[model samples]
Target: MKLTELADLYRRMLLIRRAEERLQKLFADGQVPGFLHLSIGQEAVPVGVSSALSDRDTVSSNHRGHGHTLAKGVDLTGFFAEILGKATGLCKGRGGSMHVADLSKGMLGANGIVGAGLPITTGSALAHKMQRQGHVAAVYFGDGALAEGVLHECLNIAKLWSLPILFVCENNGWSEFSPTDRQLATNLEKLGKAFAMKYRSVDGNVIADVAAAAGKLVGPMRRYPAPAILECRTTRVRGHYEGDRQDYRDAGEIAALEARDPIRLAAEALAEAGAAPDLIAGIAAEVDAEIEAAAEAALAAPLPKSADILADVYTPAEV
Candidate 1:
């Protein structure tokens, strides 16, 4: 737990927090189009996992993927622009909130379908396996996505081929409108055993725990391409999104999770390790400014033109 590493983690997590907060505001103000899924409380999983990977490694993220994208070094301006559906976006405004992607940064995209990123990551892992490259593929999804049939199929293929893949399950305990208890028959870790792959379960609320666990898995995957699963038990600070009323949750359950907010936990750990209080404040201020600038820029930016509706969907013949 070096002071510098802890500080950097804190800074990254804060950026996710502030950026999503700004997105929430913009979503409500009608600036951002399409459905939005926020990675508000589960910042540690993405940041921690990404910390262990090289830039060449890739991640396939779920709808709640802003944290994962940012952790993988996606440009904040470009991401915000994509959410705003601006031409300056990574997808050139063709893919909106649910489809923001930057292959250069190794983020596949935030897929709209439940558990769709699993197979995508498995394919990426297979590509790396064929090249015999040291790069690893990580896919982040919620507990909700576990219900998808493709996830199990992908898991089987990755393990069978011993592909370098990390399947991260951000088990926040809800599948959108359905609760995990109702939808899932067994635990996620148990499913890993059926696939005969390496598996780990961690308290995703603590970034340190997540970092340590993630570090342990990264090395093995590179050495011997095998499928691995890390089940992070975390929570969502906001409703599924800004507008979700969260009618399914009890007041007490939300309160309990909020009381154990991971951002606060990380800040406290850093402060105890001799990080200056003002340094933490400075980081917070910096993130706030960056997010605000992105929001303003996105709002003033041009939207995709009606003429370009199907341009990116299929490449036109080179004439």
Candidate 2:
């Protein structure tokens, strides 16, 4: 990889890491409401794939979607404010942690339902294809979402119509509280084959590996009228949430995964490539400062008012 590209990827990964860490702390301290699904360990996928996308390309994310949005260049203050339900939030405090959306940036919002974003992404891809725009849509989901019939339907239609959509599955081995092994019967790649979709699996823990694999697959989908899937085998570095006792996770599993922290891995790669250690340290420090600022801003923002509850609701026009 080029030095410039590597530097950018390293910074992006660091941003996601620091942001998620700050959010986790805020959620645990009761500073934020609603359930918070973290993308702590799975940060590499979004940082890598999104780095390859232009501003025009769209992305639809899952419950664990904060990292995806951040990687897509969504505003930091607004994102933090949104999760805190502040008046200046991305959704103007109307949507909580799970329902954040920013249409201007092509983030179709984070879905609350399993497999919901797939079909939405398919439509975005169709829009691009119909408008003859050289753009693609990427949908990020977990392996558990594969159990949803909508994923299969979306893949089938996308393949049939040859939509410029990329289906990215962050196979972290668990779906909410249930382990993936208990839920999925068949392998995920097999389904992609059934749809005649081009597919590849990558080490989701490494940003370079992810970017290389995603970059390869994105070209073919754009050049032809086809859809593709990249299964990123990643892991969840933390619990499902702050409250869960993590009775499901094996002992030392989190610690072991921490050893493979994507940010650290990338920094090491940069260091080995003769990049200045102080440069990498400075990048990490910048991200840390951003996280701290966002946290303080989120904490100080005013809560949404009750009178504006129905401000966003709209009635249909007369027939």
Candidate 3:
């Protein structure tokens, strides 16, 4: 990867890492409302895939989607505010974290339901193809969604019509509280082949590797307009939700995953690529300051008014 690109990736990955860390603290202190599903150790998937997409390209995200939304260019303040349920949030505090959406940024909102993004992404891809727009739609989901019926149906239809969509499965080994292997026996690559779609898998902790793999698939997806799947083997450092005690995970699992932190790996790659140590430190410092400022602003923002609960829910037709 180019130095500039590597720096950009590192910056984004660090932003995600720091932001989630802050959110964890905030949630612990009773600041954020509702359940929080963090993509703490899965930053590389969104950073890499989004880097390969254009501003016009669209993406759909699942419950653990703060990273995806941020990587797609949602403003930091709005994202934090949304999570904090402030009126100044992306959905005016109505959607909170799971439903955060900014259509202007081509983020089609994060779904709360498993496997929900598949059809939404497929529809967006169909729209792009029908409109002759040289854009693609990428969807982020977990390995658990592989069992959802919608996933296979969407894949079959996407292949039949050659939709310009990328199915990104962030397989973190665990589905909710259970290991994925215990719930499903199918190989993702072989499943992709069943539908005759392009498929690839990579180490989700390595940003450069993920980016390289995403670029190769997403590049041709726009020109030829076909469905593809990129299975990223990742790790989730936190519990399923913020407060759940992780008795299901083996004793050393979390520590072992932390040892391969994506942010640290990216920094090492940057240094190896001739990036100065000061430059790397500066990046982390900048991201930290940014997250802190956003968090402060979000905490101080006003709550949504009770009267406006139904304001943006529907639109009236022109008279």
| Estimated TM-score for each candidate | 0.97, 0.96, 0.98
Q: 1 or 3, which is superior by TM-score? A: 3
Best by TM-score: 3
Q: Candidate 1's residue-wise lDDT over 56-122, tens digit each?
A: 8989887788899889988888889999889888888888778888898888898888899999999
What's the C-alpha lDDT at position 294 in model 1? 78
**What does each candidate score in C-alpha RMSD?**
1.3, 2.0, 0.9
Clashes of 2: 1
Q: lDDT of each model, Cα atoms only?
A: 0.88, 0.87, 0.93
The sequence of per-residue lDDT tens digits that candidate 2 reaches over residues 1-319 is 9877899899988898888788888887888888888888888899989977877899999888998998999889899999988998999887767788888888888988889999999999999899877789999999999899999889989998999999999999988888898998887799988888899999998889999988988876666757889999998877776677888787777679878877778888898878998899899889889888887887788888889887769975679
TM-score of 3: 0.98
Q: Where does candidate 2 clash, by residue pair?
A: 162-225
Task: Point out the worst 10-residue segment of candidate 1 by lDDT.
Answer: 308-317
What's model 2's lDDT at 252? Answer: 77
Ranking by lDDT: 3, 1, 2
